[model samples]
Target: MNRPAPVELCHKNMRFLITHNPTDSTLNSFIEVLKRYGVTTVVRVCDSTYDKAPLEKDGITVVDWPFDDGAPPPNKLVDDWLTLLKKKFQEDPGCCVAVHCVAGLGRAPVLVALALIESGMKYEDAIQLIRQKRRGAINSKQLTYLEKYRSKQRLRFKDPHTHKNKCCIM
Candidate 1:
């Protein structure tokens, strides 16, 4: 059965708040929020499976934290993004990382939670903080990714059980 789509979740700081399949019009909403908050850069997750995203000319320093639609970050992209996030944490400790995807449910939150983990936060703590910071912390799929990213399976193939037809299957 088809699941409900993901929804946009906004927050005051860029503390990992991203959109769920934002439209061209919705992108304007994002831009407006970023402008109001004086945000300069964003760490967007390009879909490794479909390769869809906003134009490259958006001028945002796009970081390809690759992840498939239903899967987690690929091995190569996972290590690459971890290194990037490590550097960013050292340089921009307090800055926010906006992880956007077709939907906030899948790749976006997974990357955000991973960023939290890289920022020296515990896995469970990271998930909870994300939940508090961004009301829509993650969906079942993203949580599955987080679970794997927390365990030994991070950066590997996704868990079959976690990749279920959940409440939101973005």
Candidate 2:
């Protein structure tokens, strides 16, 4: 099967593997590729659902956070996704998060860009970085949202014992 290779984007401790949806014929190969990147989680932002058993069998967590095609994600969805990522990275610093929409060009890149921006990267820089790695990423509407995006305080993982912020993307 001919599938586009996953694009790897990294900023400090955060790493994201961006790719298109895998068909049944290519799923095995996809898993192998994800393993090579030490991916511990796969986040799907597309409308369809795939069998999660195979990935879970390999100890990779799969999360489905579907949104419309060519549209930016809702504010709550973005916040929740950042929280999920923050917790995952805090638990495993070396783990990579694989994110995909149908083509890995629109929704997936937008989410990754938002994460980068929240992690102290400028909006334009984030867009440039993703476009460099995954060509044709981020549609115009999505770009508009990103252009106006103001990074909120960094997502923090709190230390349970001390009630202090233990980990932050920034």
Candidate 3:
């Protein structure tokens, strides 16, 4: 099934593009579009066995973080993932990150919201922004989790080589 073009989310110093699963035909085109928008990184938050595999060529890096439908990742997991993303962002400020799930609905939104919240956006505001960009991004359960979610101690990832600690968004 042919999917719609990826939607451009917040774009400025950093660009975020979100989309549904792309069919074989749409994958290349989508990559090209992402390239046009300076997207050098992609995070596939879908299940394994999706058609296309990630590539690290042409100045793009794709990584997979799969989860079952409607299952939001745990806070630590989110923190770890966001830490990796932040490291990538910090490495190349001009790079854009594209995140997607099966339908760009439940899981994708949750990940995006967490990323934004970590980046200092209010929970309610993050939901609103995602909903405006793509309707049906989060359902009630996810919303509830967001509402009640709080971290006692922030998780950070340090580069083993450089020993530099990288913090996730807030």
Best by lDDT: 2
Winner by TM-score? 2
The parts of candidate 2 lying over 4 Å away from their true place are 1-3, 155-170
Q: What lDDT is reached at residue 1 by model 3? A: 61
| Per-model TM-score on C-alpha atoms | 0.60, 0.87, 0.77
- Clashing residue pairs found in predicted model 1: 20-103, 20-104, 21-102
Model 2 C-alpha lDDT per residue in residues 93-143, reported as the tens digit of each score: 647999999889999999999988988889999999999988889999999
Ranking of all predicted structures according to TM-score, beginning with the best and ending with the worst: 2, 3, 1
Better-scoring candidate (lDDT), 1 or 2: 2
lDDT of 1 by residue, 148-169 (tens): 6643322222234594555855
lDDT of 2 at 90: 83
Runs in model 1 with CA error above 4 Å?
A: 1-14, 46-59, 133-145, 148-170
Q: State model 1's lDDT.
A: 0.55
Number of backbone-clashing residue pairs for each candidate, in the order shown: 3, 0, 1
Full candidate order by lDDT, most accurate first: 2, 3, 1
